[model samples]
Target chain A: MYSSVSKGFALLVLVLMNCIMFSAKAANGITVSTEINFSAQPQQCVTLHQGRDCFATILIQWQRPTSQTICLFHVNKKQATSKKQLMCWPESKAGQANIEFESSDNLTYQLRTQLDDRLLAETEIIVSWLHKNTRRRRWRLF
Target chain B: MFTKPINPNIINRLFIYSIVAIAFFIAATTHASPEEQSLTTHGNTPITKDAFEWQFMLDMALVNSPVMLTDVEQTELWDYVQLGLLFDISYKGFFLRTNSRRSSTILGGEELGYQITVQKDWQLDVILKAYIEGFDPIEILDDQNKDIPELVGLNNREYTSGIALRYSRYFENAIFYIDIASARASENEQGHSATGIIIDSFYSYLIPYRNWDIYLGAGLTYYEKALMDYYIGINADEVSSARPFHIADSTFRAQLEVYAQYPLSQSWSFNAGITQSFYSNSIKRSPIIDKNKLTQLMVGVLYVF
Candidate 1:
């Protein structure tokens, strides 16, 4: 009986030690994981004229490990506004998320992602306006 | 009636004399005007210009004043040394700028620095900075008041030197600017060094009604360490020893700041700013000693000639 009692106490101590070790490991664990993948389209060319507006759709793809939610945020220079959305579990897929932005002269766009207020990734895009066809022809002749 | 008829010539003579007397009185009054008009002709004209076309301003203000150190959490009370020089050329919107400062005892040792920038309607500014800093050790001997024997001296010496490039645009009453630059620094004894890239952009709006201007800005900084041994790599046998310094080996920093400037006169202005930094890597992981995550407050005066 005494042997069984001692064995039970030893098992309890072992479980406690394991619990402490796991917590410590979690606290100090430094892992480098790629959190977000972002891509945009036309995927190539966008054209607009000075004093006119144009639009393009941006597609973003993000992957989070295990159980985590990703928040995507975007800003446009020409429109001077920001948009954000949440990707929850089960519905989040490995595909392009569509976004739209208006183009002005020398328009630019920046996008970033966050998970629970922690920034994961960021990138920038630029768009320029094209001159009219007649103007282009005149310049070519000159 | 008969006596009066005989005196018509005399009456005409009296009327003529009266007319001459009136004309003399009018001429005398006009010629002898008040002394006020006479003084105006001889007195000095308004002093529109001075002998020296350009003036130099030398100013010294005790920075510990409450107005200068408004935010307690961001600002620490320490001895501050500031020096500045500005030259205004004859051409409009052309100037030369030089500024330097030294602040002591906040983190330990001193930060000595100088920068030169050119001023135009739009500023194309270039800045250079050099600093020698020493970190205080955590454990000090009671008798000697020196660092503990186990600590390495390489952890104390941090020398940083860098150049910055900035472009600015000025509006009628406001200014906007963007800056991008890179810096490299190393410690000789440890063979440890870091190279960093920084990009900052900001806008300042003039609030003329209160004689002050407000500024808002955001900045991003990236740092990568070329040598890891100086930061966190430990000797094979010293596994249990704690690394007293926490340096971010490779990290990203983002910050937002607000600032205000008030002009005291044409030659003197007061400036202040509060900045908060967000870190990607832990501050305790840095190789440098006693570095922590905190907001910073800076306030100083600008003297323009």
Candidate 2:
């Protein structure tokens, strides 16, 4: 009866730990030791014309000193009021994701703690253009 | 032996061919789209690499004083609604482009060409384009089948397309272009073809004002004897007392244009333009020529993709 009671206690502990991890409530369990470094490859998206939508496959990477649960949010600097959570990861030290991005304006990719929504690391995708007018030239040769 | 008669509306066939070329070129260029785009965006982005790009536009315009009429009998002012679908497709070093304008639409205004070289601010290209648009008298008559007195016996001038070498210089707010072309006309019913040499030059300046781009441009064209004679000259056998046999000489024509474009959305735009063309004495002296000057006004909406 004592062994069964010990097993039940262990099961309950495991369940509690899982709940704490998933619910992002491990605020006192572990602390970030060092700075979180985040970056995105192909940092700039370029279109042929100024008004065209720029498209690119962005490679997002982040590294932390210790394993921790965090989520990524995409924020458009033009519309600061709206922020979208792209993805979240279970306790991990380093992670990378490939995302297809298409937008007319610049976008910011941010990494933050899921528990307190504290900003950790952020990178920006700069949008640029080659020509001012979209291929519609006024060549009126009569 | 019976023979097929020549169609006076041969320019329509040429326009249709140009439309087909636009479609074919657009399809061909799209084959090198994103799949072939290199992902070497490391430091700085190189804008024009080995890329395939396309833009499709639908343009409609209300034109005043159409230039298609060559008759001396019709003196009343007439208005016309012109519609055109234009396309620009580029791949590697070649491009096919079309422009929709009031006077040029009678024969499809297309430039099929390959970019030979692009220097710091200069570009050179080899192109195939139609220099002169043909006119159909039947279509211009009061009725479809009725023949106008002035055009009863006049032979229709067939549109001419030719090889051209174009040189362009880009400036901060303007551009200058010069073209030298050897235009070739299709064989007539008499089994004879004509070739003419032409030199054209134009300058366009852009003015930016409150989300609108206004362009002021001027152009000059030098036509050779063969082209002028074939289109405007009257032949001996087909000449009457009213239209005596006459020969045309090489001439220069001048034109001025003011054009503006406003963007309504990311993919849509509105454009309006006015053009005035003045003929020289050489062109005015042609037996069939009616007017010394032509004026046109056009407004259009464009959707780009």
Q: Rate the local accuracy (lDDT) of all candidates.
A: 0.37, 0.64
Please state the error at residue B46 of candidate 1 in Å: 37
lDDT of 1 by residue, B124-196 (tens): 5564433222222221122223443434332322444455676767675455655565655555444556656
For model 2, the docking class works out as incorrect
lDDT of 2 at B241: 60
Candidate 2: deviation at residue A3, Å?
68
> Mind sharing the TM-score for model 1?
0.37
Whole-model alpha-carbon lDDT for candidate 2: 0.64
| Top-scoring candidate (DockQ) | 2
Scanning candidate 1 chain A in windows of ten residues, the lowest lDDT window is: A133-142
DockQ of candidate 1 (2 decimals)? 0.01
Clashing pairs in 1: B246-B284, B246-B285, B246-B286, B247-B285, B247-B286, B247-B287, B248-B286
Q: Residues B1-305, candidate 2, lDDT per residue (tens digit)?
A: 00001223435645775666667665774566543233333555432422465555566665554442344232332234545566666676567677535234333466778877655477788988777766544445533334446566666566677899999888877888888999877666645457899898888898765446788999998888888777777787658766778888887879899988776644467778888887676666765666767776777776554
